[model samples]
Target: MFSKEKIILAYTVEKCKKCNLERKRKYQEGDLLFAETSKCDSCDGIAVIEKIFGETIEK
Candidate 1:
């Protein structure tokens, strides 16, 4: 039998500046770049995608 592996991407949520609220954002494997900056929609806060890593899962 052969096993299949899948790559899982993860991210950390950031707080909004104006409201200090945290929102759940979708994280795609290639959507974000390492050490890239983003924005918070709720409060328009300055956010960044500091860390990104991949995990292998057996399927």
Candidate 2:
């Protein structure tokens, strides 16, 4: 029997892709930053210290 193999890749969180817009925004320890998504607006976002991505490969 062959079991399924789980694969995970490392990830990192940076500011929004836009500099002009990001300039006005700021990030604290718990500020959510939404990535560049077509469905999201300029403010559509999550915290910078996200729990899901907080457990990456320890950078």
Candidate 3:
């Protein structure tokens, strides 16, 4: 019998500074995310990562 494999991913929440609207997205450590360049859905302004949640992969 083979054991089940464990797959991990991370979920992050971002907030728009202009609108205060929050959004959830998949997060990775190596990703180059800048609030200045990233746009928010509600305000079309810069979006910043507010918090990180859920299981993350260990590598």
Top of the candidates by TM-score: 3
Model 3 Cα lDDT, one tens digit per residue, 3-34: 66666777777778899888888876754443
Better candidate by TM-score, 1 or 3: 3
Where is model 1 more than 4 Å wrong at Cα? 1-36
Number of colliding residue pairs in each model: 0, 5, 0
The candidate that achieves the highest lDDT relative to the unseen native structure: 3
lDDT (Cα) of model 3: 0.70
Which of candidates 2 and 3 is the stronger one according to lDDT?
A: 3
Candidate 2 vs. true structure, TM-score: 0.25
- Global CA lDDT computed for model 2: 0.36
| Range of the 10 consecutive residues with the lowest summed lDDT in candidate 2 | 50-59
List model 2 lDDT by residue over 1-59, tens digit each. Answer: 87566555434344443332322332344444454422213565422322224322322
Residue-level error in angstroms, candidate 1, position 38: 2.3
Model 2, stretches more than 4 Å misplaced? Answer: 16-59
